[model samples]
Target chain A: MSKAERKAEVVDLKDRAAARQERLPVLKTYKLFIDGKFPRSESERYYALTSANGESIANVQLGSRKDFRNAVVAARKAFPGWAGRTAYNRGQILYRMAEMLEGRRAQFIEELETLGASRSEAETETAMAVDRLIYYAGWADKFQQVFSSVNPVASSHFNFSMLEPTGVAALLAPEDSGLLGLISVVAPAVAGGNSVVVLASHSKPLAAITFSEVLHTSDLPAGVINILTGTRKELLKHFASHMDVNALVYCGSDAEEIRTVQLEAAENLKRVVIEENSDWQSEERQSPYTILATQEVKTTWHPIGL
Target chain B: MPRNNAALAVTLPPQFVPIDEVGIDERVSRFSKRSIKKSSKVQALKLALSMLDLTTLSAHDTPERVRQLCHKAKNLLETMPELPHVGAVCVYGPLVKVAKEVLKGTKIHIAAVSTAFPSGMAPLKTKLIETRQFVADGADEIDMVISRGKFFEGDYDYVADEIAAVKEACGKAHLKVILETGELNTLDNVRRASDIAMHAGADFIKTSTGKVQPAATPQVTLVMLEAIRDFYYATGKKIGMKPAGGIATAKQALHYLVMLRETLGEAWLTPDLFRFGASKLANDILMQLVKEQTGAYQSIDYFSME
Candidate 1:
């Protein structure tokens, strides 16, 4: 064929490929994470997740209060062991999780594409999520050094304080970021030695569960991280008021609801960390100091005289 | 007739004043002749600043960056006392909250650029919903772009009705209709857009979305401001003006201010009549103010409240 005809043929092939892509069936799946296992809901209730174009991509189970309780219990049970580990060991585990995430980057990108993210956005979010994990992982051992300070007391007692993890935290991941939001909230709390019960993004829960799978595959002990998929109104109230939850971390666009939860947390004086609706792509996200700011330090004094 | 003749006869001998007898003093002409002193309040400058393009500093220029730019601009505005508070920080819908937080408790309002922004290619329903959501997120203003596609196709009614719908959806929040004069390609189209927007209940007529390559030139701003003046004169209702996109430095802001002062006079100098949609211009103005006050150029580190 002539050069022009060959170019026309190539164009024809490209058009056919595009047509084929439009006709491909969208796969749908959903399950809950309880004690490091993907389990079907006891109630068997499922909610349809749709795209901006109104096409159904998946059906996510509407997890119940019982599911939330179970996750919290599992998190509480796992917290002692996970929190007891040395900071270096936890850092290494988080770092390894980042590597595993990098290995499955394509899976996340595919899931994001199904959830309506543009190809470029999906790639950037996936890379940023992995990098965020790595960034927080590095801060795991150093957060204490930055947040902690030795006080110069008038007396003989040496006084120094270091940030301590608030245990069994509950997080409401942002709806826009399917995987990155899940990882952003969970990794920071976990790196600080706090076990988390994450309420997955209602519209895009598949990637959250998929990341849970990655966590399960990693050396993370069962119950150290529990993922529950449900409505924010349904699950967030329980998470906020639960006496056992030591802290609450919420990341979403619902300002009023988040504020209500913050007020509820005040009933027990539970530590509240509300991530404002912010562009995660901005320079504000790179501040390692924010992760340290969310935690607290506990100090004790001893006498060395006689 | 007799009474009129007697009155006219009494007015016959008027006092003669020669040019030399009239003591015309330079100070009298300079001071007592309605001096029309320019306002030292910087209100016109503030309005021009509100329409400036403040997103040039981003790593990648997109709607998201436009949102961040508004946020940074809002933060910078917090420090200035002389500049009239901006009407709103215009950005994409997703970043409305960022501007909301940055402008919390201040007179300045949050404005989101909707209707597909620079292009206005999205469906009208989507644009309306996006505008509504931004208002729901505490945006006090909506800056929507005219559909360039429809405009180019000579679908003037479609473009006008879209602006009307967005204006209605804006509820109590004011709507600033952007003409994208650079894309309009003619002063006639710009004038037509201004008239259409005004007839459609637009609170203000704006220029450019800042995403287009050639945004908010002085010529365009001058034309739009003249249109606003004409519309007001014809209808006896004042319409505001916003010249946005690619306006940065203090000198450019001053030029627009000068234009508004010279063209619209004092009435359009307020935030209600004029605004600059800028992110970085606020800081540059503030930096200049600080230098003028302190007699030294402060380091960039000094403005690190963000």
Candidate 2:
């Protein structure tokens, strides 16, 4: 090409670059959510998050086992009050969380977009997350009636069985689905009146932190749902081995992590539930059984003698 | 003069200087930031274990619980035979005999919370009676709470006399004067209380009763440590320091150790000079030691609960 033509091409490219730089996006500082506060990881480490096209988007806190340990402490501390709240009050809090999520829809969608989800897919995930909250909110009070049983014994005794929340649950949110999977896991656990410490999707954690903000503002108590940003493999063992954590819920396909969780959870006889499914958007994802997964059945017998 | 007795004149300092709150906080934060690494961290954890006064001062504590606590004080972790047990077993005055039975020939001693314990509302005669009883029951040390009401009334003489009276009653048992710093509500008050306790004959100056709102924070502990340091310089006698309550994490324990070391040097690292009055701190230290020995984190389930 001639010098004049090459110069013209270069000028056009410079104009394009200037136009793109006119509006710089504000980057969010993603941090670990422990007890109800967003703190830089105690380890002070970070992991770069990039778009599918390899464009750097933001930096996420690379939580250490210490962070998970802190989260478990928070979860255990918050367990009694969260579990003791009236079922109706818990339902109301969950619904309030849904309201807060609704108010933050655009932010969640934007975060999803940064994670490289298509615009429509991002909106869908955000909506599903809000719906998941609402769904669990409805079930919070109803699950008791649905699952409880008044048993007939051979003797003249009043026998009844009911479900109770397992204390503090440590969970790994599905690695593939950010907002929706997180809501699905946490809603069921919280609906069953259990406090949860969850490690968010390592590859896509923006929405999880945003969701923690929602939980923070709503009536939900501090430490009811703690979110951590880090690699699942690195934090999985800590999540499983924490003595204070009463339940372990995993939603990932990695075989080694599954095995490790099972083996470590046996130390405390923690309720280990592993549900690895890829399609979170499917109808089968929402069920009372998910709530039951984090609950314990307690039976009582009282003799009816006057 | 007995080597253990210091400042025979017993003249109270004319004025306790007001601490620089911001400066103390900044220094504590700095001390907290020291990056203790692997082998050294393990060593520090062990040292912290050796400094713990495994305490169970609950109102519901039974002889069985006291015995169990003493048992734990003697054998922190059977799996790690080399690990030292906690410095002592602390229980209510009435249960001192139970703990003494379990701790008979071991290096672990028995600390009894006497003088009405968590509360110091009783008459002086009653407190002396309690202290004398605990000593007779074989308690190696007596933890006594000061009268905050009298201190708040500007009755400095009453406070000093109470400490001296309690000390006389303790006789052979070492006296730990708990200022209950949380009730004092100010750093200057904490400093003044520390001076009063030390001048009136306290072997160890403690921060709280483990029953108050804000027990044993770094600022308060630092102020008390500084008081010990000053007393040591003036009289050429060492006054031990015990930061009891709210120090439940290995990291927090390390921070306290750092402060103690920086303030009083390596001599205070031993159980005799420095100690932690805590029921949960021992388990947390053991968990850290286990985590260090085995890369995997620990469940409290594996550790026997007293």
Candidate 3:
């Protein structure tokens, strides 16, 4: 046969094969993000996620206390480096994370919709989440100046109060709006220079786990934000009690759980910030105060110069 | 065993075979993939806890810090008094007195890493003096480093003599010969060193000085454990194995335990025969045990930092 006819025959065979079978859609395995790496929960236990129709979407890792402990270890290890970075550098890294989130915006929207969000709601939430990251990025360098003050004293000493990152913070993301709530809690803590162990909203975790991808690729140092997909009730007590965690931010309104958090946190005197039913899209939620909530104030006294 | 002149002349047994690189890599990958979950996992973690040689070998380690470590070794899980304590507290010779004082009236033994420690570069006389000083200060075990430079120089006799001398200096205190396997760079050399240390009267054959990279890798550890098994077959003596350093997580500790159990059977399961020379493993295991009982994820923050 002529060369052209041979090519036609090859194309015919390829078309026949394509017609016979199409590749299946790839489903991601959502694992816990600890330190800079992806790890299945050491418990090896998994809870399945379903759509509105109850069809299984994926298996999200059931992060146990061991997983949280490992994440805390990672967060603590990353804290020194993250907290020590120049404010400008941290801002750039946070901005880079925003950029990554923007790039993967469509995937996040799709994930939200798959978990029962309307298209418009998903789109708006995803946009808000990206904007929230950028908001925090800007605050990374400016929050210290906004919160710090030089105090007037009677003595010969010049006293000044400056905000410092709380080292390692435990974050329980709001059980509502995946994209907005996770980013709102995480963005500020990271902006203020604290590393965090964020338990993504169990009912709405896809966006959070997907956000870990944004973090993984961004210039933000590893372990700055460890995102876990698990129940807050089971993990919160350990989160509150862990001695290494300098602060814990809980974003739900459960009275018993709050009491447990308070009681457990007292063991190590960890700072507890409760955000009960707070709307992430509200003006109140977009302030530098959220960042300060995860920070500790250091007052230094300097001798007055002649 | 005395430092016998005739035993020093005895050649290494033929079972000190060359390590198969591909085979070892494959076997280790398999070990890394195996998961022991639930109650069995908790039991394994607790066993691993009992096998820990809680180490603080930094040059900056103070008596206060060592004392704190000894306290941690004894009260590994103070909140849960039923939890088992660590096998021993490992420290430098100078800190042995403080560690012993803190560990007084406790079942936890104090292990001192002598023989010039991480660098084994000091004169043999100085190492001997240090060993005796540690023993005098009430160190129950002596973890001695072999001169790697001499071993790499093919001075097997010198290496054997050095280990023997340190073992003699250890006297009633058990002697653990650290091969610093990272520096050895070859599994064959590690196997040979294991044999030499065993023959030279090391009560325990240890993997690293916690100051070296590539410490207690599964492949290297397996080779040493095999040497131990062979030594047991020949002399009917159970020489302990300590895979010290870089083993921080509970999962890694249990992996070591599983390797030990499958390789040497239940005889080596106890802390007396198979120990983990690890600084962070105790807390990690404690976290796991708490997670098991409480159904909550733990944080190092609530756990003891030391």
Candidate 4:
């Protein structure tokens, strides 16, 4: 071809490339966070996410039951290391998570807004989620003190009951308050040293995926908190029935879902904590008692000197 | 007939067996993808369980710990009484008697690692004495480590001679020559060492000593299994295969079994012809078996920690 014709072809190609760059928006592929790494669903399946007004968002990973099983395995593998950490150290890490979340406030707010929340509501939810993390951070080192008791026994023995974190916990984040509800349930469980496999809010999962980024950077050990974005209806049964999960914490009070969780959990006799139709944004939601729900009471007796 | 025929020596010469690294990786990946579910999964798990040589080779291992491991090998999860006992209990030479004492009445053989174990750095005389002593102390199997240093130095004959000497010292006890493929560095070397060990009269060719990184990987295992198959084809002798270290999951154990069956056929799928030298693999197989039975995943807490 002639030099003039070649130059014209190059110019046309450059123009099309520029137009493509401007027209196509860069979208984040939401994936499951298991064992501290971001991986697509094991089944390689995805579901299209849409906003309240039918505006298309992006395709999110459709995690299968195998994903939940993998998360449980990760949580179980990380339980001993997480639970073995000093309570003060756990508190510091939880506080650091709050700090990381504060740094990502703008990102979370934008995600919430894209999910159909108003600017002010997104701001409030992000702030409340950060504050909720701080609330649990403070409770991390003090919950055992409040829950423990020196029992008075009739025998010549010294008896006392102390609180220990339950093993692996499976959590279902509330469908409404995506960010706040997730932090409310997760912060408490991790603060008490229970590693968790959480199913993020089905309708508002953008903030949850972004929140996992905050957790990734906060020195919280991997597998201590695994988050999966998928339909809760499909995953809740496996989450509750997994024998490796020592505790099941369901944030929503849907009668049918609660019944399924309770029934499946009976197979392993797991500790089931149901928060029915609870307002995660309420002041009552942030407390030490939330941390205590995933803890077990260990009573020990020391024989006195005769 | 003599275990090591004169013709075997001619075929066992250490020569370059060029390995296709890409081909091995591709073949090994397929083993893990096979869906052995339901009754097949349960059968594979039980078969894997029966092939386990539950091992504890730590410096911290004591007589009490050996006794505990032997007990676990004999009675894996008392709640599941129908489960078959493991193939053997593997321990240090000094601990073999301790394990033998606990596994007295059971079919579980006591396999002892000798010849300086993880590091075959001792003299030939020392290795023979260790092997003979363990055999005299009631060990039914002797897992001897081949000299990796000599093998790397192009001293193929020395490596073969050492394995032969150790095999002679083992007398009637089956000899499992540990190639410790982790240090061997290449699939070609793994195949070469496997060929050398088998020719040197290794009744069983093992992958690791449970003390090295990158042990018993699928690629290395496939190479070793292929070597064993070629050797069997040439000599009409079935040499057992043990991919020992780093095989801690039930799924991985199943994968190894699949590779073995596909490579060497079902004739080698027995405790007499195959073994898994692992401490954690037994419980995982038990957990999988329990899951298959109850239709629920199991917790490690429900099983004993050996």
Task: Choose the strongest candidate by DockQ.
Answer: 4
Between candidates 2 and 4, the one scoring higher on TM-score is 4
lDDT score for candidate 4 against the true structure:
0.88
Put down candidate 2 lDDT per residue, B1-306, tens digits, no spaces.
222334233567778778888988988888988999899999999999998998887889888887777777778888998997788888888887788778888988889898887789999899999899889999889999999999999888778877888888888889999999999988999999999999889999999988887999999999999999999998888999999999988999999999999999988889999999888878888888888877666767678986
In candidate 4, residue A87 scores what lDDT?
97
What's the CA error at residue B198 for candidate 2, in Å? Answer: 3.8
Kindly report the docking quality category of candidate 2: acceptable
- CAPRI level of candidate 3: acceptable
The docking quality of candidate 1, as DockQ, is: 0.00
Per-model root-mean-square deviation over C-alphas: 25.2, 6.6, 4.8, 4.0
Candidate 2 lDDT for residue A226: 92
Per-residue error for A78 in candidate 2, Å, reads 2.0
lDDT of 3 by residue, B82-118 (tens): 7788889888888888887788888999898887777
Cα lDDT tens digits, model 1, A177-262, are: 78877887788889999888899888888889889878878898898888888888877777776666788888865778877898
TM-score of chain A of each: 0.87, 0.91, 0.94, 0.93
Q: Encode model 4's per-residue lDDT on A38-62: one tens digit a residue.
A: 9999999988998878988988999
DockQ of each: 0.00, 0.43, 0.35, 0.67
Write candidate 2's Cα lDDT for A101-179 as tens digits: 9999999999998888999999999999999999999999999999999998998899999999999998889889999
Per residue, candidate 3 scores C-alpha lDDT tens digits across A49-108 of: 988898999999999987988898888889999999999999999899989999998999
Per candidate, native contacts kept equal: 0.00, 0.61, 0.50, 0.72
Model 1, total clashes: 16
Error (Å) of candidate 3 at residue A273 is 3.5
